[model samples]
Target: MLASILMTVRKRRQPIIRLALSTMVAALLLGALACSPPEPVRIGFLGGLSGRVADLGIGGRNGAMLAVEMRNRQGGINGRPIELIAEDDRQDVEVAKQAAGRLLAQKPEVVIGPMTSAMALAILPQFNTAGVPLISPTVTTNALTGLDDQFFRVVAPTAAHVSKSAEYHFRENGLRRPVLVCDLRNKAYSESWAGDFRTAFERLGGEIIAEVGFESGQSLAALASSVLAEQPDGVVIIANSVDTALLVQQLRMRAADLRIATSEWAATERLLELGGRAVEGLVVAQYVDRGSTSPAYLAFLRAYRERFAHEPGFPGLTGFDATNVALDALAARSRGQTLKQALLTQASFAGAQSPIRFDAGGDTRRDTFLSVIRDGKFESLQ
Candidate 1:
């Protein structure tokens, strides 16, 4: 009976010993974790990787990649590496929403795109609810101006920048009368661009002789004929590169010598390829001056060309600028500050083209340039 009582006592003591040992292990693990370096910061990049406007999305993604890779090569932010999580929204609203849901689950502190204004609008509300900061590289919808949300952009608003283009056409280009052409499919961008340009040009004593609309995959011959009938001094084509190419080709067939200009919306490689000789001598407004020789821009350009075998254009340049802005915010976060507050309070960022500054409404202000297509390449006239 004494032996049995000793056995019970030992069993109870064994439980107590195990508890003590487990507590010690837990404490040791916590100490080691505290002593180790922090994990890499997560950044999400969402853009269209497939579908019609994939070139712009690809360019933006490439730019973001360059920024992240360069930062990593230079020791990253405060010794913590950065891991970029890229997603393709396919430029569809529902797809963008789904992609955003998945990305938010990854808990990225910041996100880099939704390159088009439409995609940005689609996913911004969800990101706002999650309190994640989203900086777009090329979203320029007029409706997004002054929006009280976490959405910020590197490109200027459509109304503001397009108005400047109007002034350029009237004052510098010496075009008194012009016809406006818009793509109805991308009404959000094309309509706003045409409307803003019309309002500004008319205010500057220029006349809009005609307004024409067309849809992609439809014959633009009738629309082109109607526009040429007006015999305007110049034609303003506000559409994506493919649609712009079709319209310009049709117009060129009628009057080869007619002056033509394009909104920044259609400024892409696809334009040069599809429009061919028709796009030659076309004046276009651009957010980035590709001819900039600034050291910072030159470094970026060289790296970009080396990696992609192509020159960086507006989408790439703006994407690089936007990602750098996010990196700055991340750096601030590592120092016990909030990302949103840091972005709002930080000073201007000198970018590839000009100094970029954000207003209280998160709109970006920068200089624009007028470029002419010479030999199927953009040559900055500014």
Candidate 2:
């Protein structure tokens, strides 16, 4: 009788034991679910971060990074943090292709840059194949403009910037004859910019005396001499900041009073640092208005200075704006909505310095300002 009773008791405890085991498993799973972190939204950045154009790349990268950091602090997109992956294209076509391949492998929601027009053209095909959109901070070549492809830029096209500078040179600056020094390294941008400037300036009765083309490593002294051979009243330089600064220095050594201007591509903090007095009167168009008292711009300037310990310049400002546009679209996109579709759905986005609006072809325009380097600063040309 006692053995039977014991057996009955054991049978009753079986269900309890099973129930306890199931409960423990449920508790462990819940604990794990609570402890695990959420997935991050991946974003990619591509630029020539280690070459002659590194200043622009580094500035752009830092700006994107700062935007991601700030957004993550504010609870991120739908509670998921953002992860920015950066690649240096080294300003080489092969390197840019490899970098794009590496960035695409990670499956980013969007990419923020190629910095220059050449890099954009180099890696655009790969990004299109992967169905990823490239939101460039500074690639303004007309070749990419009005394309319904996977490319979009925050700044206007080459014509928008160069034409304005051309008009300013012809009508306002009273430069009747000018020579162009084109950098062949960035052939796409330099050529497009020079072509537009030529059209605009010539239409305005200004003459281009000569066009001197050179690669980056060529002798700036010889190039300067060639430019001086034309005996032009003014000079326009289309090159990177480093080369532009060196060429300006070379020209200054020969003709102290020659009026000089450069493409906005060469307008960076490095130009002032390297060119010093030579770039003092150098005129160029800028995407940002430095004299603005806008709260958004002031906040960005302060944050950028604090984060990077320096000025953000054009690249940084555009980088920040481009990344924010991506993030806004990412946050607002509905289920099953493509990133391109999401971007186009919005009427406009608020930029750090100004409002940004895109056309149906994913082309946007910013207010370009004509500024001259004065007292080691970019001052508005009144």
Query: Could you say which candidate leads in TM-score?
Result: 2
Q: For model 1, state the Cα shift of residue 182 in Å.
A: 1.7
Q: Per-residue lDDT of 170-224 in model 1, one digit per residue for the tens?
A: 9888999899988765666777788889899999999998888877567788889
Q: Where is model 2 more than 4 Å wrong at Cα?
A: 1-23
- My TM-score estimates for the predictions, one after another, are 0.88, 0.94
Which parts of model 1 are misplaced by more than 4 Å? 1-38, 229-231, 334-337
Model 2 TM-score, all chains together: 0.94
User: What is the Å distance of residue 369 in model 2 from its true position?
Assistant: 1.0
Q: Per-residue CA lDDT of candidate 2, range 1-382, in tens?
A: 9999999999999999999999999999999999998989999999989868999999999999999999999999999999999999988999999999999999999999999999899999998899999999998899998888999899999877677898889888889999999988889999999999999999989899888899987999999999999999999999999999999999999999999998889888999999988888889777788888999999999999999899999999999999999999999999999999999999989899887888887889887888999899999885
Instruction: Report how far off residue 299 is in candidate 2 (Å).
Output: 0.9
Clashing pairs in 1: none
